[model samples]
Target chain A: MSEPQILIIRSVSFQQLDQNLPKLQEAFPGARIALLTHAHGVRQAEKYRAIHRVLAYPFKEGFHYRRRAADMKREQFDAVVIPVTNLSGTGFFNVLLFSLTIPSKRRFVCNMVSDIWEVSASRIIWMGVRHLLFQAVSSILSLLLGIFAVLFLPFGLKRLSKNK
Target chain B: MSAPLVSIVMLCWNRIEDVRESLNRIREQHYPHIETIVVDNGSTDGTVEMIQSEFPGVRLIRMYKNMGIEAYNIGFANARGEYTVIIDDDSFPAPNAIRRMVDKFEADERLGVVAFDVRNFYSYDDIKKEAETTDTVTNAPAANDYFMSFNGAGAGVRTSVLRQIGGYPEEFFLYNNELDSAFRIWDAGYKIQSFPDVVAYHKYSPKNRTSWRAPFYYTRNAFWTAWKNYPADMALRITIQLIYSCLYYSMEQRTTVYLKAMWSAFRDRGRLKGKRKPVERTIAEQLRVPWNVNFTFYR
Candidate 1:
């Protein structure tokens, strides 16, 4: 196979980049690495030696971000990697969404401890669906709690004031 | 005329090296009349001892436990300066930044807060390089001219105005407290402005980069801010937007942090009963940014 072009989506933390980028380089020898990060982080990311190109994801929505994403998709990277420092917590959702938007032949997820694994696009889509289901259920419960507060808090406050 | 006293209030919790450097930068400020206050949030890493020994002039308040952003209240209470500069343990103003902020306030009686140009750096060397090379301008426009909120990382508040608003919501713990205070400041007929000339460096430490607490508090406090400050209709609209955004984020991240935050916000909303004095429609319009802009830019 020809030398691969790899893109790494890192939201923050250069330390994570330091830890994970070398492993990626070792795994894909002679690969051209590009770093994509938040606009504010572009300056810092540029200083890293491993990255051949740096792409800034605009912090705003609308046409600019969409255009940028389209531009990245045209790059047609062979592999895309997301460096996640935390696995148990809400993984970097913004980074994940951005990664999914760009077309890549292979997708890899890496953690702070240097564990990298390839995940199928379908599996990621399934995770997204599960999250939506969970969110729907939670939203109903939250709305009920909010309704309860609105209905009962005034009375509680009035009684407390009378006691005072 | 003598320069108005500018009090620098900083919060520290176990980040000894960063705090030390921040205090040193404050000491180097050219602003003549200044007082420095450091609130130690029950740090076990000898941060308090270091501050006491090295910075003898700084007034230090020690909390028994980590009270989060609420500990800033103690520091503000003790501040005697006409304007108070709020900064994190890892943040500090440039030498002339405070002077420029004070001038901005002096020039505009309606101005209540002056936000610094907060430049975040991952390493101390980069911060030092930027500080040395960057030229200070005497006049600069507000970085976010239409936006009302000031960054808590490095912003100056008129003490009288801050007192009028009753300071930050103690229950917020952390995150979005600035927006809560900004709403009150605007409602009181004061403006919050930011200038490119007034710079502060924030050492964006890499540690604890992926904690769930940040997303949780940010989500929860955002709801409370809207509930307590926005007009009823505006609040409802913003609430719906926030819910949608949170749910979308939760789905994308495959985590329940947003759900928990919403639940917590609902449960603890009673704390905001008497505090719910929504701002006028004009102020609301002035403060409002498009939801997408707010989400992508700020959050």
Candidate 2:
């Protein structure tokens, strides 16, 4: 019934970009949102400009730490959707305890983290079934092709084998 | 010359003040016999003049241009002492750091590499305790924590072992250098050890932006390392990883960055392919990380 604000917490790839933004927009039709990204994610946030704010967080190896703390503390974001691999250290460590930091309510925590990072055993089993089907089909096709070749090979081989 | 217990071989480019601060720690050590070799990586910042004027006795191997990581090889080749340390110019070793590492190496012959804790240089004071203690934040013990995988930063590696393995893989150019070397070390039949108590400091610049060639190096080098070291059974995971990353990059509207990562991998894959070595591992452990995500240093 009401709009919900979000923070893109970690750095993630763009594959899930389209649906995530629009779906969130539709879910909270009139809700306002903001995004926080590392230097790499800034370019990505440009596409979904409907959100309130998009700021790039620097991650240089030689960058300053005081600046990192100030930035994390100074910022005001409701929900963070950080889809990054290694956006931890001072960055995530600081934001993990933000007053507004919802604990696994948004996709940031649900699918991207602990409660979200966990996978169901049934899901794993389903993945295994698909993997097996792929292997089985490939094997069956090769076997049939191998039998066809075996029957045809004797004609051409009979002359060569006789000479041998 | 009391046969110096250890020699620190550092590769530096510019960052004169950073280099000086790092060298000062070694010079101030109470340990009697230790050497410091600073390979000036073609620094125009007058770093050469500073080192000459200040640390006159410090071994300064001045090169005309950037020989890349090859400078490390030159430093290792010229090093003396029973153990040699490969330290980054920006990385500063703690007081008595080398002494502690050498003591451990001498105490254990099987110890191919000895690591001490490395805390963020700028945040060391803020994160010193967290870095020194073993916590869940990090999956494995920090190399700077005294006993890590013979990390390249603050670790004690036997001179004989390094010479045998040919030191760091010069072909790496940038990324995947450690894993490439680690695989060879593993193949050579020696255990890599970590020491948590021995702590040093790594003062990293806080400007971690994914710019220029960062994406290229990160994705490309990671894939290259995986292709080379992934057990044959685990080889296909490379494609899975690539697809996963590519799709994610695309969905995130970071297609350009993803493409750059792919290009970097393709361009530099030959080097990894050339050095590829098949590794032996138990079927079970190979399924776990450190088995896979072990060498993942995300950019």
Candidate 3:
């Protein structure tokens, strides 16, 4: 029921990081988000102050990936979403110091790369539907608990006071 | 001259520099017979002055205010060519792109359109991968392949086909107007094919991308485009894609717009119908084939 800090990493330059960020922000208000981008796209991150951080890296000779890993390690995000397509290959790996790991959510676009969690716009949507149902059920239980407290609690409190 | 090799209808708004660059390419064409017209969609960016001075020899049609994207239809109505080619001013076809596409029409009278491989400047890498190969829209007939794919940035269509199925819709100001046109051509017994070798590069601008209008019309028009063709299970396909889209994009604001677009398309279904020949493309009744594309609403 709480907002999760969504860490997003795509191969796109830093400039377009904010394009999808605002859409995410509108979906989850005040949600903490940090982008893992390349050095070229840093200006895009500056466009929004609400961005917790923008991690940039040099894209040659594997330097860019190291920066990406480092950003993930520093942020320690709740969950990550990568907007991948069949044409793309960027996928899961939670950030950590000295050691690399897989993301909490290992999803990518299906019909793209195989042997990985397939992610698509469809999955993002159904997850929201499931979330609403869970919240709705929990709300009903909270309501029942409030009713029980009101109906029988006055007599119970009075009896406890006399015993004391 | 020979009914003009191809009539060029350029739909433009504002960006004069981009169009001027494209017009330069058009002026250098090897084919001599041609008529080019620029339809100004009520741009306030001094596009009229630029077109007049820079593209002096070309004809110009100026609208008082933005008449939506259907303004191209006005230019099309006035076209005086046997074959009409619609290209956005931002995108430039190769010198021989028109000649190659026009050749296809001459090769086959029934060929309604020869849709060239419309490439964007950003997608050069993607195009380079297949530069060595030769590709055609469909080497076969329309009945053999079915009319499913189209891109309007660079393509030569028969003027007769335009009359047969009616021309482009005035409503879909930007996105997928070609797609809508493609289906109508197929339903009316004509064909639109993609010729891979006949390439047209879109020259995507760094400052201006087509996406500012994407979230609005792209999301909404996708389903509406399908609805215009598919009679049976359009609703189910749209609903499935809607859920599918949410999975990929985790933003409620974008999702809300997508849902609203579908709702609006349904409410305004009256506006879409009767504009062209009714086509049968719903998912339930669809005949799945190797080349037959599943036109799911992907915004």
lDDT for B120 in candidate 1 is: 53
Q: In model 1 chain A, where is the ten-residue run with the lowest total lDDT?
A: A155-164
lDDT at B56 for candidate 2? Answer: 83
User: Judged by DockQ cut-offs, is candidate 1 incorrect, acceptable, medium or high?
Assistant: incorrect
Pairs that collide in candidate 1 are none
Off by over 4 Å in 3: A1-164, B1-4, B122-146, B205-207, B210-212, B233-255, B280-299
Query: Over 4 Å off in model 2, which ranges?
Result: A1-164, B1-4, B126-151, B208-210, B253-255, B272-274, B283-299
Prediction RMSDs, each to the true structure: 6.4, 14.4, 17.7
lDDT of 2 by residue, B22-60 (tens): 878777765577788888879999899999999987899
TM-score of each: 0.69, 0.59, 0.59
Best candidate, DockQ:
1
Highest TM-score among the candidates is held by which one? 1
Instruction: Order the numbered candidates by TM-score, best leading.
Output: 1, 2, 3
Q: Give the TM-score of candidate 3.
A: 0.59
